[model samples]
Target: MDVIGGKWKALILWELENYGVRRFGELRRGLPGVSEKMLIQQLRELEEDGIVTREVYREVPPRVEYQLTELGTALNRALEPLGDWGRDRIERIGANRVHPVTT
Candidate 1:
């Protein structure tokens, strides 16, 4: 739970899995609600956990992109069923949105 815990981690993995390699700005743009600091921290932790790879290129402006490692790919695949379950629950909850009167 620790490795892929929190609001941002799973979303981050989803973006990389769907989009392939992405730069810092691309990640920020993809995840609209995430702040810069939170994104940086999440990426660092993911990298440290060997879930993502960060590559830097030398240039006038430094370029860095992140992609999932092999282990990360496997983990993401494992989570696909969880995603489907969550989506089903979301639909069910939405259908049952009417609340009962409380005493």
Candidate 2:
């Protein structure tokens, strides 16, 4: 869970799940405001955790792409409920100016 316990990880996973496989540059472009260094670190961590697969093409410029593994896909599915809950909460908060109390 630690691997996915960051602000960017879930967003990254969601983008990957929706977009299928993506190149490093493409992922970076998809996620605005994410630094290149942070993206690299997160991708490395995900790859090391066996949740994301990184493929390197033996080309002149060395193309690379990242995709989620089966485990990662399952994890995303598990997080769907939480994601929906968050979306609903956001919508409710938008509808009602009353701020939600934080514990």
Residue 16 Cα positional deviation in candidate 1, in Å, after optimal superposition: 0.2
Local distance difference test scores for all models = 0.96, 0.92
Off by over 4 Å in 1: 98-103
Error of 2 at 69 (Å): 0.3
TM-score of 2: 0.91
lDDT of 2 by residue, 1-103 (tens): 7979777899889989999999999999999999999999999999999889999999999999999999899989999999999999889988676765567
Quality of model 1 by C-alpha lDDT: 0.96
Q: In candidate 2, which residue ranges exceed 4 Å CA deviation? A: 98-103
Error of 1 at 103 (Å): 14
User: Deviation in angstroms for 43 in model 2?
Assistant: 0.5
